[model samples]
Structure formats: C-alpha cells, structure tokens
Target: MRGLHIVGGNQLTGTVTAHGAKNAVLPILAATVLCKHSTIVNCPDLSDVAVSCHILQHLGYRVQRQQSTLTIAREEEGCRDVPPEWMRAMRSSILFLGGMLARCGRITLCPPGGCALGGRPIDLHLSALRQMGAVITEEGDTLRCTAPGGLHGAAVQLPYPSVGATENLLIAAAGTPAETKIIGAAAEPEIIDLIAYLQSCGAFIEYQPGGNLLVQGRRELPGCLHRVLPDRIEAATYLAAAAITGGKITVHANPAHLAAPLAVLRRMGCSITAEENAISLAAPERLQGAGSVVTLPYPGFPTDLQAIFMALATAAEGYTTFTETVFPRRWAHVEELRRMGADITVAGSHAVVRGAPLSGAALTCTDLRAGAAVALAALAAEGESTVTAISHIERGYADFVPTLRTLGAEITLTEV
Candidate 1:
C-alpha cells in the first residue's frame, strides 16, 4: 500500500497544466479496436490507462506508450475473450464489450470493478448493445456476448445520461453500418471527446434534438490520430486545492468545460478569471460556504467534485448543503472527514456541513473522488496527516502529489 504524507497550512500557488481526461481516454482506448490504427496524444499516464493497454494487448492489439502518447495497431492472432481478472480491475473495462463485439463479433468478460459510488450498474450498456442486435448471456459471474450476424444500428434510449453507457453505445454504433440514434445520452465533455475521435475516423456522429446523438457508422473506419481534451475534473480538484488552502493557482484547461464547477467556486468566494484555454483562481483568506449545491448531469454541478467541495466546505464560513442527485450513497467520505474534525451530518443523499477549520488526522480514501477529498482536507488541516490507499488517487489524477507539490503543497508519497 502507498500513502500520501502531507503537511498542511501552506497556501498553494503557481500553475499546473491539466492532463487529458481519464474518463475520455478510457473509452477512446476501447474505441481503438474499431480503427485500423490509432494514435492518441495527451493521454494521461494512469494505472487505469495501463490496465486498458493491457486489455488491448490481451485482445491482440499492438500497444505502445510514449509518455502521454499512445500508438495502437491491430493483430489478428490473439485473445478474444478478455480475462475476467483484468475486466474486474476497472469499471471502464465494461466498455470493451461493445468494441470487441463490433470488431471481433464476440466478447466474454465478467463484471468490472471500480470505486463504489452507490449503484453503478452496466444494465444500460447491455440494454443498448442488445438493442443493436447483440446476444448477451449470463454464465455464473461472467457475461458472454456474441453477435454472429454482426451488430446493426438501432435506436437506444438510456434511462439516464450514463456516461459509460453513452460511450459504449457510441463505440458500438461507430463501427456498425447504419444509423443509430441515442436519446437521453450524456453530453459530458468526455463524451464529446470520444465523439470527436469517432468523427475523425469517418464516424458520422453529431448532437441532435434534445441533446441526443446520431451515429451514422461505416463498416470500415480508417482510424485516426486525435488529441484528448484537458481534464476538467482534475482542474476542479486543483482549484479546490487552492480554495481549501486559501491560496491562488492557475490551471491550464479549457474554461468552457468547467462552467459548472467554476460557478460553484465563485459562489464560494473564490475569485475566478477564465480565459479561452486557462483559468486562474485566487482564493480568499477564508472561504465562504456556498448555499445549496446539487449534483446534476452536464451543465450542472458534477457528482465527481462533490466530495472535494465538501472538503472545501469544511474550511469555509457558515453552513453548506450538498444534495447528491447522481450518487445516493456517496456519503462514505463524511465519516472520514469527521475523523479530521469536520462537523457533518448525512441523511440519505442530503448532507449538511457546518464550516470549521480541520486538524490533521489519519484518513482513509474510500474512492477516487473521496481520496481527493481527504487529501484536500489534509491540505487545510493544522498538522501533518497520512492518507493511505493512494493507489485509488493514482487511478484518476496523474502525478498527483508531485503536481500539487509543484503548486507549493507540502506532500510526498510513501509506499508501505
């Protein structure tokens, strides 16, 4: 196990360039199988990405990584059924089902694993692929999918805007030969990033009525060389880092992708200046707790940043309320925050936090976002702190401790 050893109280300052979106790159990695060759620039060097590359290699794709760049090529002789253990490593592995079914006409894999945030089901993904004429079966703990006659396009209406489902269906539709309409699709920036890569590979994908998507796919995609969008979630984390520590920092990212979180930061009394491709945040000496913050789909407060905001709320003045509409059972961090002296109460999806300065304590990271939350809390705490299970933190943010250290954070990683 590895942990972050942190000394709080120093104000973070300076600029940190954001890495590519982990959410975006995972789906794009899955999408690589549909292309003849793929070159992805600006991909983050994350453990999840390595897992994805290993999955690709398991499926007989030639994979190479040059720092943040990935070059992938296809090979015929290799494994078709992804190992159950590999799929169990990350939730994004579920995405390869559609890509494999499109490219190889079959796939066998078990349920994927990731941070537990309430009910994270892949029914939406299976239902969409089933709508596209793929036959999926349940055998014990594994799922077997086959499209003998090959997949065809069909209308897929998701119950909710599930980002993973949207990406899976998009990957399936991008390689199928016909028109597929996706309603209630997630319009997240990561989804847009995947769509852009698909479009570059001759996949006809565009936003239509009601924020839905249309995919007019072709049998053969020549493949593409695409660069991923900067990670807005990572940007939000850094901005929240500065906010919690009463500091000033600038993140090189696309401001348009961060309107939702930027609005909330400004509400918290952080001075935000956004340019076309970068955002500068100057936090006040003391943060003021913002009123009701709700997590909604895109163009609203993000569920991923809820924990970080809760940590920031701990150092703010007055009371703050967080209603997590996206993930009902994400309050695991509340208990961990309480360990650090945060006054918090949670009843179902609603959490009301009273602002108070935190003192360092041994913290446990429950999930990726939750890990970021506790780290942020430690950054604002009075004394030194140890946050274990930094592997969860590495699953999302790249060079997390080192990056924050460059921004003036007194943090280091200790493997144990």
Candidate 2:
C-alpha cells in the first residue's frame, strides 16, 4: 500500500486550477454509449474514469484516450453482460444499466461496489426502471433486467433527490419513444452538465423551475463534443485545505457552483474574493467556528464536503455541529481525527466538533472524502503525520499530492 507522509505547520500559498467534475464525467462517459461517436474533453485521469472506460471497452466501444481527452465510438456490437469483477470495483458502473438497456433489450451485471458510506440501495433506480416498463430479477449478487417490448416514457418521482438515480433515469428516458417527466430530480450542477451534453447529442432535455426534468426521446442521437464543468468538490477541498493551514490560495473554478461552501467559509472568518472563474481565500490566523451545517440536496451544503469541513472545525475557535442527512455512517473518520487530538463526538449521523489544537499521529483513511479530511488535519497539526489508504483519494482527486505541493504543503507519497 501507499501512504502520505506530511510535515505540518506549513501555510499553503499559490494558485491551482480545478479538474473536471468526477460526478459529471462518469455518467457522461456512460451516456456516450447512446451515440455513434462522442468526444469528452477535459476529463480527469482518475481510477474511476479508467474503470468506466474499461467497462465501455468490454462492451465493444472503440475507446481512445490522449492526455485528458477521450473519444468513444460504437463500432461493434456491445456486450450484454458486464463482468462481475468490473462491476464490483466501481459504484458508478451501475449507471450503464440505463444506456445499455436502452440500446440492447437486456443487461446482466453484478451489484456495483464502492466506498462503505452506509446503505446506498439501488432500489430507487430499479423501481424507476420498472416503472418505465422494465422487468428486473435479482439472482444472488447479480441483477438481470430485460425490456423485451422496449422502453416507453413514464412519469417517475423520486422520494429524495438522489444524483445517481436521476442520472440513470435521464439517460434511460432520453432513448425512450416518448416524453418522460421526472419530479424531484436532482438539480445539481453536474446533472445540468449531463443534460447539456445530452442536448448536444440531439436529445431534448429541459429543466423546469420546480425541480422537474423533461426528456423528449429522439429516434437517434448523433456524436458530439463536450467539455466538462470544473469540479466544485475538488475546489472546496483545496479551499478547506488552505483555511486549515491559515494560508491564502486562489482556485480556478466556477464560483457560482460553490456558493454554499464559500458562504460557510466566509462566515468562518475567511476573506473571500470572488470572480467569474476564480476565487481567492485568505484565511485568518485563527478561524472562528460557524453555526450548525445540514447537508441537503443541490443549492444546499453538500454532504461530500462535510468531512473536510469537520476537520477545519477542529481547529476553529468554538464548537461546530455537522448533521449529515444524506448518507448514514459518514462519520467513519471521526475516530481517526480523535487519534490526532481532535475533540469530536458522534451520535448517529450528527457530529459535534470542539475546536482544539491537534498533534500529528498515524492515521488510516476509511474512505475517499475521509482521506481528504485526515490529510487536511495532518497539514494543520503540530508534528509529522502518516496517512495510509491514499488510493481512495486518488479515485477522485486528479494529481492530488502534486497540487498540494504547488500550494506549499510538505507532503510526499511512499510505498510500504
């Protein structure tokens, strides 16, 4: 395994540009199967991206990558069953269900796997598909689905704004025979980006004012080129890293997509300067703790950044409470942070953090975002620290260690 050895007490400075959004690119890559030819530019080189490309290749797509650009062409007949091993490596692999089913009348694949962020059931996606005239059967770890009569348009409403579920339905509905309306759809910027890409491919998609999405199915979609939006989660992570170390950093990203997190940091006494495509944050010598934060759907605080914010709150002046309503058992990093002298108490999905100076200690990352949280804590601690399971961080962040190094962080990767 590989680990990060970090020397604390360094103020991060300089500027960095955000990479393409992982959440956006994964589904967009899957949607490429809907067209005869497609090109995705500004794609991040992430493990999850590689896995998605491999899945596409297995399905007989002519996939080619040059640097950050990916060109996919459907040249041969795609496979109907995805290998069990490939599906088990990535949760996003489940997204292929909608596009594959739309193209081929049937698909068989095992349950997808990813980070252990609690119970993330795919029941919503399955139910929505069944509502759209799909027959699904579960056999042990595999799921076999068939739409013998082909799929048709239907009205589907989500109990919650699940991003993955919304993307799956949107891709499926785009290839349907008629108009499909989705209620309570996830209105995240990534979802909007996917819709824009689908529209470029001749699919008619509209976002109404009240969290409704309308997808007008077309007889065929043509190949198109698209550039992904900048990753807001990555931008937020770097911003929080700068704040925890009491540094100044300018991030090149879309400021409009990061309104909620940036507002929270500004309330925590960070001097924030906003521009059209860039944001600069100058952290105070000591940060002040903000009030409680509740992770909600789009336009609200994201659950993805909750862990990193918790790490920042550990060193603030007062107590900060974080309530995660999106995912259960997201506090897997609380114990690890406590090992480094952080005062944290977890009760179910809620955690109360008491600001206290932290000292460096050995830590193990439990998941992707939790890895980032520990790295932030180590950067702000008083001594040297070692963090293992860095592979999780690499799954999302592109050039993570190198980017932090550019910001003046004394961090290095070592294999053990």
Candidate 3:
C-alpha cells in the first residue's frame, strides 16, 4: 500500500498539462484486440491503462510501453476465457468481451471489478449483445458469450445511458455481420472517441441527434495508430484542486469537448480562460458557493467529477447540494471528506455540503475519483493530512504527486 502526505494551506502555483483521457484510452485499447496487426497508442502512463495492458497480455497479446507510447500486438490464438483473478483488479476487464466475441465469436470471463460505489449491472451489456444476435449465459461467476456465424447487428435501445454498456455494444457491433443501430446511446466524449477509433479500424459509424448512434459492421478491420484525447475528468480534477487551494494554475492540453465542468468552476468564482488547445484556471482569493448542480450525461455536469467538485464546494460561502442521478452510491467520498472536518451529509443520491474551514485530518480513499477529492481537500486544509491507501488513486491519475508538486503543492508520497 502507498499513502500521500500533504501539508495544507499552500496555494498551488505553476502549470500542469492534462494527460490523455483514462476513460477514452481504456476502451480504445480494448478495441485493439479487433485489429489483425499491431496497434500503437500514444498517451499518458496510468495504472489503469497498465492494468488494461495486463488484461491484453493475458489474452496472449504482446505489449510494449516506451514513455507514453504503447505498442500492442497479438501473437497467439484466440483466448476463450479471460483470466478470472486478473479480472478482479480492473473493472474495465469486461470491455474485452465485446472485442473477443467480435473477433473470435466467443468470450468467457469472470465478473469485472472496480469501485464498490453502487450496483453496476452488466444487464445492458448482455441485452445489447443479445440484440446483436449473440447468445449469452452465466456460468457461476463467469459469463460465456458466443455468436456463431458472427453477430448480426440490429436496432437496440438502452433504458439508461450507460457508458460501459454503450462501449461494449460498439466493440461488438464493429465486426458483426449486420449493421447495428443503437438508440438512446451514451454520447460521452469517451464513447465518441471509441466510435472514432472503431471507424479507424474500418467500422462505419454516424451520430444522430438525441444521443443515437448507428454502427455498421463489416468483415474485416485494419489496425492503425490512435492518439487519445486529453482526460476531461483529470483536467476537472486539477482545476478543482486549484480552486480548493486558492491557487492559480493552468492546465495545458485540455480539450474543449467538455464545457460543463469548466462552466461550473467559472460559476464558483474561479477565473477560467480557454484557448484553442489550452484551459487555464486562476482561483479566486475567496471561493464563492455554488447553489446546486445535477450530474448528467455528456455536455452536462459529469457524474465522474461530482466528487472533486464537492471538495471545491467545501470552502464556499454557503451550502451546495450535488445530486448524482446517474449512480446513487457515487458519493463514496462524502464520508471521507467529513473526516477532514468538512460539513457534509448524504441523503440518498444527493449530498449537501456546507462551506466550512477544513482542518487537516487523516482520511482514507474509497474509490478512484474519491481519492482525488480527498487529495484536493487536503491541499486546502489547515495542517498536515495523511491520505492512506492511495493505490486506487494511481489507477486513474498519471503522475498526480509530481504534477501537484510542480504546481507548488507541499505533497509527498511514501511506499509501504
């Protein structure tokens, strides 16, 4: 286990560049399994990506990482069953099912694992696959899927806009025998990026209004290099850290594809400036409270960023309520923040945070983004704060400590 120790009340200053989207990069890597030749991806080196690479390697794919570039090449026959124990470490392991079924017509894997935030059901994933003409059944903890004579795409509608389910359908439909029309699709930037990469692999796809997407399946796909876009969640996390610490910091390589989080921060009295390729944030000397924000799909307040935003709202002038409609249990960090002297209360899917002075205290991270929230809160606290069990944080953020240190934050990490 590893822990981060932070000396609070230090105004973070300097410039930090946002890395590639962890959300986008993971699915893009999973899509590589559909390629016949080696695929090269240039992006940040995050632990989740490393775990995705490990999953690919377990499927007999050879992966080489040089700095930010990852070269993935398949060297063996199709793997029917994905390693079960390996699946426990990463939730994105479920992403392999779609590609494996598309390429080899069958895939067996244990249940995926990630943050225990809520009940993340794969029902949408199985339903969409079945709609695409794949037969699926559960064998204990393992899910076995087979599509003999390849899948034939059809019109499928999701009850909710699930990012993981949408991505799984995209990968499965990319190689099926029939064209797949996905209604009520998840239009998150990561989903769009995955569709774009699928198009690069010779899959035809188009976006319609109201988050509907149509993917055309074909017989063959050719591999190509893909450069993942900057991580909007990571960028928002950094901006929130800046706001919470009353610091002035600039995040380079932030994509304008996301505007909701930036807009919310601007409303919170943070000075936000944007150019063609860069987004900068200068924290106000005194942070003002934002009334309310509801987490929604893309182009709206992102559920992924709600935790970090709560940390920024802690020092506000009044109370702010964050309603997370996407996932009820997403507020795992609320209790952790309360441990650091924050005034917060969670009611069902909503959390009310009253602005207060945060004092340094020991806190434990519950999930990936929750870890980031506590880290941001620690930056603004009055004394020393120790964040224990930071292994979850490393799964997403790339070089978080170094990035914060470069921004003049008094933060250090010790391996246990």
Query: Which segments of model 3 are wrong by more than 4 Å?
Result: none
User: What's the C-alpha lDDT at position 104 in model 1?
Assistant: 77
Question: Candidate 3 on 1-416: residue-level lDDT in tens?
Answer: 78998999889877777788899988888888887654555577877788888888888888988888888877886564778876778888888888888888888888888888798888889988888778998989878789887888789999998999999989888877577889999888889888878888788899888778888877667777777888888887887888888888777765576588887788889988898877888988888778888999887899888888999889777888999988888977988888877899888988898999898898898999899999999999899999988989998998999999988899999765
lDDT of the candidates, in the order given: 0.91, 0.92, 0.85
Choose 2 or 3, whichever is better by TM-score: 2
lDDT of 1 by residue, 1-416 (tens): 99989999999999989999999999999998898799999999999999999998887889998988999998764447989878988889999988788877888889999888988888989989999999999999989999989999888889999999999999999999889999999999999999999999999998898979999988878898999999999999999999889899999999998898888889889999999999999998788888899999998899999999999998899889999999899887899999989999899889999998799999888999999999999999999999998888899999998888998999988876
Evaluated at residue 200, the lDDT of candidate 1 is: 97
| Candidate with more favorable, higher TM-score: 1 or 3 | 1
Q: Ten-residue segment with the worst summed lDDT in candidate 1? A: 76-85
lDDT of 3: 0.85
Over 4 Å off in model 2, which ranges?
none
The order by descending lDDT is 2, 1, 3
lDDT of 2 by residue, 1-416 (tens): 99999999999998989999999999999888788899999999999999999998888888999999999998777455889888988899999999888878799998898888888999999999998889999999879999988888899999899999999999998877679999999989999999999999988898887899989976467869999999999999999999999999999999999999998899899999999999999999899897898898988999999999999999899989999999967888899999999999889988899999999999998989999999999999999999999989988999999999989999999996
Q: Using alpha carbons, what is the TM-score of model 2?
A: 0.99
